[model samples]
Target: MSDPWLMPDGKTKVDPFVEECRLDEIPFPVWFAPYTKGERLGDMLWTGGSGLKIASQRMIDALQDAKITGYRTFDVDVRDHAGNPIKGYVGFATDPGPTTDIQNILGQDGQNFVFIANQRVVEALRAHGADELDIRPYDPSEFD
Candidate 1:
């Protein structure tokens, strides 16, 4: 099964992802669906929907230890494929602080947003392994 809000006919019944959400619009302590696939490894992870920044506890600790800013963390509850509780994870959000003027990056999935991670974030993501982000430079002018 896909996300709960996904219909069998390939449509979504609810707004997908927390990307454009305002602070008050989202419920604190985000809840994730059962993770039934993959090794569930990586300090940073991607879910099918609900695009909150899911980071492992080690990543969170590293971020805090480095005094990273412009983001907030929320508690999250996740269960493995077998309904086993998966601990040591949290959801986070950033405020787009201190960005350069080379603006408006695009996501590989045009419908979603992709962001650049700095050295601090890269270091944090290395808790398990290298960040496996799909980077595709998009220049929207080609569509014109």
Candidate 2:
């Protein structure tokens, strides 16, 4: 059978980095962040739910134009507290730094508000001032 995450056309539906990073290599981090209603509203106004989509499309276009392959956008889920269901999207690549924009809007450190389970990604995020995280060992069964 085809890979579960692949599209019908045999293309990957998620980020290609998910595979390159060996995200399934047992105990990789899945990041999370919860936003307030106001924050959500502001994001909507800023991107109209198209920021990542547009960026991804543009990246794809550029890659196609250059005849390059294997590049993809980073995927992140903005979910509710339970992390059961994804409620929105946040592009890891497009996220503003903690000191510049997002943190100012959050009125606190963005890292303090973000959640991540992957140690490697967490370290990267923390290095950028997104130090506040809920780091935990990866549990695949929890997804089910």
Candidate 3:
């Protein structure tokens, strides 16, 4: 049986990843706050889409560079007053491996925003900010 939400035309469910992988996809309000500078696995929000074009452009350019690997994007839920994720936004991070040009993006903001890289990405994201980090995984069946 197929899910009712599935399209009547039998269109397969598309993964959110398909959108982020696009070369032209640009996210907004992306932040680069401070992160724990050490050996640890973590994630970061490359874009929050809060009307900040500069921040978003920096992240996009970095990601576009061929040097970045393990680049993946996920739909992080940042809710507003009504409890809805702000539109035109998404979060991204690379695997726990060093790469080039990452510093350019991180260093660009300086103290204006924390340079959230690797280990520090999660903490910096969850820290005092309008964009909340919804990195925690959810399994609907587990709740059911």
lDDT of each: 0.53, 0.36, 0.34
Per-residue lDDT value at 115 in model 3: 26
Runs in model 1 lying further than 4 Å from the true structure = 1-30, 34-36, 99-113, 124-144
Q: lDDT of candidate 2 vs native?
A: 0.36
Give a tens-digit lDDT track for model 1, residues 40-112: 4665566565555566777667667766665567666666656566788776555444552112234222123
lDDT of 2 by residue, 35-133 (tens): 444433222112221222212233233333544322234455444555664443434222344332122222322212132222433343444443223
TM-score (C-alpha) between model 3 and the true structure: 0.26
Alpha-carbon TM-score of each model against the true structure: 0.56, 0.24, 0.26
Worst 10 residues of 3 by lDDT: 46-55
Q: Clashes in model 2: which pairs?
A: 29-118, 32-115, 111-130
Cα error, residue 23 of model 3, in Å, equals 24
**How far in Å is the alpha carbon of 21 misplaced in model 2?**
8.5
For candidate 2, which ten residues in a row score worst on lDDT? 45-54
- All models, RMSD in angstroms: 6.5, 15.7, 14.2
Query: Candidate 3's residue-wise lDDT over 33-132, tens digit each?
Result: 2233343212333223221111232333345443343344554444343444444444443322255322223333211122224433334334423233
Q: How far does residue 44 in candidate 3 sit from its true spot (Å)?
A: 9.0
- Stretches of candidate 2 exceeding 4 Å from the true structure: 1-26, 35-41, 44-72, 94-144
